[model samples]
Target: MATFLYRIGRWAFRRRRLVGGLWLGVLVLAVAAAALAPSGEEADLAMPGTESQRAFDLLDERFPQSNSQGAEARLVFRAPDGRRVTAGENRATVADVLGSLEGSDQVASATDPYTTGAVSEDGTIAYSTITYTADAVDLSESAKAALQDAASRARSAGLTVEIGGSALDAEEELGGTTEIIGVAVAAVVLILALGSLVAAGLSLLTAFVGVAIAFGLVSALAVPLGLTSTVAILALMLGLAVGIDYALFITSRYRDERARGSEPEEAAGRAVGTAGSAVVFAGATVVIALVGLGVVGIPELTKMGMGGAGAVALAVLVALTLVPALFGFFGRRVLSRTARKGMRPGGAARSRGREAELPGRDAGRAGLGARWARFVLRRPVAVLMVAGLGLGAVALPALGLELGLPGDESKSVETTQRRAYDLLSQGFGPGFNGPLTVVVDTSESGDTRATTDLVVKTVKGVDGIASVGEPVLNRTEDTAVLTAVPRTAPNSGETKDLVHAMRSALSGVSSGTGAGILVTGTTALNIDISEAMSDALIPYLSVVIGLAVLLLTVVFRSVLVPVKAALGFLLSVGAAFGVLVAVFQWGWAADLIGIEQTGPVMSLMPILIIGIVFGLAMDYEVFLLTRMREAYVHGASPGEAIVSGFRHSGRVVAAAAIIMVSVFAGFIGMNSPTIQTMGVGLAAAVAFDAFLVRMAIAPAVLALLGHRAWWLPRILNRVLPDVDIEGESLSRHDPASSAPSQTSAAEPAPVRQLPVGRD
Candidate 1:
């Protein structure tokens, strides 16, 4: 393997200029390809199971009701004296308001014209619902503006008004989230690339290239594959992440190797061979991971699976092909400048420097490397125990993690419209703050009234209800959507509680009433979505774990090897998860991340972490274990191999972890809470996986497992395909019976393996 790698390194040196020029050409092509790709409304769906595809799909199907939103936003008045206004009085007031609203160009439709709206059955207050739909083949920006202008004019007419619904909320969230995500992405890229701002910019550029291409590919698939608008942005986010990440790993590795000893071209070659291999493997693992999404039978999932993996695959291609080419052309300068520090760009040299400076080291007989290894060896049990304890402590906070609405108006960016929302929510009550909806529907709208009343009565009688407002009635060209306001805040548990209350209350709602109740709200929707996610995730977990097993089994050709790899990976995940619980969930580092004590980590974050970080944890595991197995096959005892492997691989693993951490740390300051969470979780996972999990627990467990660590059932062994962990095996392939060969070689000698469980 090294021979092949070395030869490739030489080829890069020989054709430096040619390779360099090729990189330039490819970079341009890749960028151009991405640039021409579709985005936003132009992009195709990346997710499956979308009810409506286009941003305006809702309006299209309900063209009859698109104007409904404008009407929904019209003034609603109640007497300030807290007394119910009479029908006669309301009629007079509504006439004056309607006349003025008619003069306005924004009002597309109104329920009341010359007379007052109907009085409540209680005869306290009179109310009406009106819509303004200014046309532009859709809701035009100018038209919506004019509509809002007309609403403002009506408000000045003294109609107590409250406007809240999906359209207004969607528009607000879209604008806020987009601006925030953009600024966050840019901030992360620039901050990390500070010393080499150009590299940071290039990283962002690379990300855009990947994102654009993925979007275009998704768009092209729209005819055959249905997708949603959210899918586009989701795919775009993943594309940029994988792209920058792919390039980041190799570019840093290349520079590291060059700084140590390799010539510019040589460094590039080595990087391509080693880091390149890792990249391919990483991309494959992610692809394997994303492929699991296809199992959900969701078009959106399949789209995301394809588009997400496609982006990463494209990124790997760029990293391997274009990056090396760039190095070949800019070889001399990159090498000269970075090499001035006395190392190569493969990252191996940089690590060596760090190893020499590690704490508790010796300059002589028991060298620094020797001492650190021995120290770990001496206290294996203590180290394992302490590390495990620390991990557990951090994870405790996860138990308390709270899930809530993405955010409320408090989290809303300051704007007049936002201010209006704050006022509306406050005036109406927090249930109006963020209520769960229970839509009442039947074959006939009239039939729905009794069931609706029943549902409302049941809801009002619930223990948690401060109040259950009458459902606001509306009908689409086909479907009807009712807005239900609960007594609790939208995201509060009380909201969830009230949703439960309403569901139980309405179970018998239509039994004798001749109406059926279909309860759906953000909270209810999330509950259903959560249930769906759980079902989707069950197979996903199995698939990911199974893939890990298959990949490792192929790489090591031992059932025992795959099993061991899976276990170690799990331990790493647990440790990382624990840390997340401590810092993010428990506010351990609240001062640093600037989270300032929030409810809980994002619900989806852990799932993402498990997939992404576990794959990453596997990265170091593969690197270290390969070298160990090589030693074992060449004839070192299993124990000896673990010791020597840990020793030889320790510095590199630690250095790689640190660099990965540094690169990811750049994201900690990003504006997006999601990305920021990812950055912290990833960094923590890498740190723990490398130093504690890999260095300490893994070695201890393997040391204790002894020959059994590589054991496989004889029948299964014969059937399971063989992969050469660089061709390492016990004497006769029986890890239990065969002892390691003490073969002497030109490479570093194997350190003595401790007894299976002497620690």
Candidate 2:
């Protein structure tokens, strides 16, 4: 694999123009495809095989005109203190607002508060309902503007007006400011790590190009594939992060090779051959984890996984080809001024002669990583215990984790929808914001009306049921739909329990009357989605953990090493979930992170954290451990191998982890609660996995295990194909040779023997 990649890198560097031009042409084609494709629609939140989904499908088929299936807006009006909404001025204002809505072509119907008995007992609060002709996603901007205009007139007449409902649920605009800030921070980190402006700029440039191409492709294919904006957003985030990091790794390796006295082209080839191999494997692991989201059987999550996987794949390709070609253009300028000055004519020959001694003999000028590794070797047990206990303490809160879909109550207090929700709850009850719809299919019943009446009565008898609306039958009288308001808030545990109780009670009625009964609504849909996610969590974890262990075993060629990596990943995930629960569910210091209202964590957050964090955690593990394995194979003692690995790969891994955290943390500023939750969760997970698990606990564990850390069964070693991920084959080839040729497997280099050491 290293030989193959080495040839491609050298070829790309020699033919820089052709390689660069091809990527540019591909970018142009991607842009054109995006421009010509139809615009993408919002993500579909439909869950197949769930009761609420089945109920919804039945409504669309049997009662197409049912108000339950359409978008609606409630114009909540509150009069001044000591005044009633029925007073002359307030009543006239409320009437005028309803009249304007009735005149609008977008409105199917506008119900007056008086006629519908929507006024509160004190008459100080009232609300008028306006049903739209289209779904929320399909509603025209003009329709929303018209609604806002009507509310303004009511406010002008001295009545407090707020609008809420599906009609007002527009997609929030995600500005590029956050992305720009993240990229700027990454550039600074790169410059500091590489110590060259040219190198930092090159990394940023390649990452931006890769991300743009991936985003364009995803956008062009979105409509055809039924993908949503959520997928695109996630794709962009992961793509940008991995693209920059991959380029940074290759660039850092190229600089190191140059410093060791290799010519420009040779250094570029060796860098790509070595670091590029790690990039490919790391990227593959990420792709596998993402594509594995299909096991959850959720269409939205599946799309998200595929989108993220495509981005990572593109990042890998760009790093291997475009990066090397760009290196050719930059040539010697990629090195710092000091580094260029230090190079001499015979340095390459001298460096090659001492290659065997380089790994263990560099201890005199050790960096922070080397110092840290020495400390871990001295007190491995203490370091491991400290890291484990700290992470476990953080993870303890996960036992109280609660998952649910974020609703209007989770929105910022400044949003009109949240204000409307609060007003409705005050006037009526908390359940008013989330009414459950009971659908009774009476097609097989002898008397449809009798069956519908019996179903409604049984629902009303449910303990948590506040009230059941009158049943409205379809034109064929085969389906009857009624609204059931619960006695608690939409996201409350009681509401979820009420939904379950209503379903159980309705089952008996269905059995008696031979009618098909289903309970559904936004509230019920959320309940079903949450439950589905919860049930799939364990299975998804098993698949992801099993895959990670198998892949790591192949890369590291050790049983205990792979098992240790998997366990560390579990700790990272647990700690991440614990933090999420503390902030979003328990409201622990929520205001510090811009969380205005706290509720149950988003249902999709845990699965998303596991899949994404597992992939990234493996990336750090591979990049760091491969260096240690390479040092050990070349004859460095276990203690020296740990120091050698850190000296070479520590800076790059730290920079990459920091870049990822910065990019994800930028999303915390977003207005949407769902995006905000994702930002905080992913950022925290990466931080824990990168610093605590990989950097601290992993080294300590490896130090304690010593030579046994790399042990593999003889039979298993022979069965598993050697992947050559560390590019050891590159070391045997002559650096001065221009022609890229495969090396013979029969001529394996003998390992150098070093003195054994006991810490």
Using TM-score as the measure, which candidate wins? Answer: 2
In candidate 2, stretches whose alpha carbon ends up further than 4 angstroms from where it belongs are 36-38, 66-71, 102-105, 133-141, 176-178, 345-366, 734-749, 752-759
Candidate 2, residues 1-759: lDDT per residue as tens digits? 888888888888999999999999989998899889876667548788999999999999997656455688989999998899988878888888888877685788988898889998888889988887777877888898999999999888888999988898865565557756877888888887776799889999999889889889988998899877778788888998889989998998887776555777887898888898989888998898899887787889889999999999999999999999999898766766556555566433124332211222222323767788788889999999999999999999999988899888988889999999999999888998899999989888778888888887888789988888999988988998999999899999999999999898888888988889999998999999999999999999998999988988888788888999999999999999999999998888789877888888999989988988888898899889998988888778888888888888887799999999988887777777878888889988999999989988999999988888888777677677888898877876544333222332233335744222232
List TM-scores for all candidates, in order: 0.68, 0.93
Clashes of each: 35, 0
Against the reference, the lDDT scores of all candidates come to 0.54, 0.84
Model 1: CA > 4 A from native: 1-275, 294-307, 332-372, 402-405, 409-422, 444-460, 463-482, 510-516, 534-539, 558-561, 571-597, 636-652, 659-673, 706-708, 711-717, 722-759
Go through the candidates in order and give the C-alpha RMSD of each one to the true structure: 8.6, 4.2
What lDDT tens digits, residue by residue, belong to model 1 across residues 23-82? 556556655654664332222122224221221243335344443543234344444455
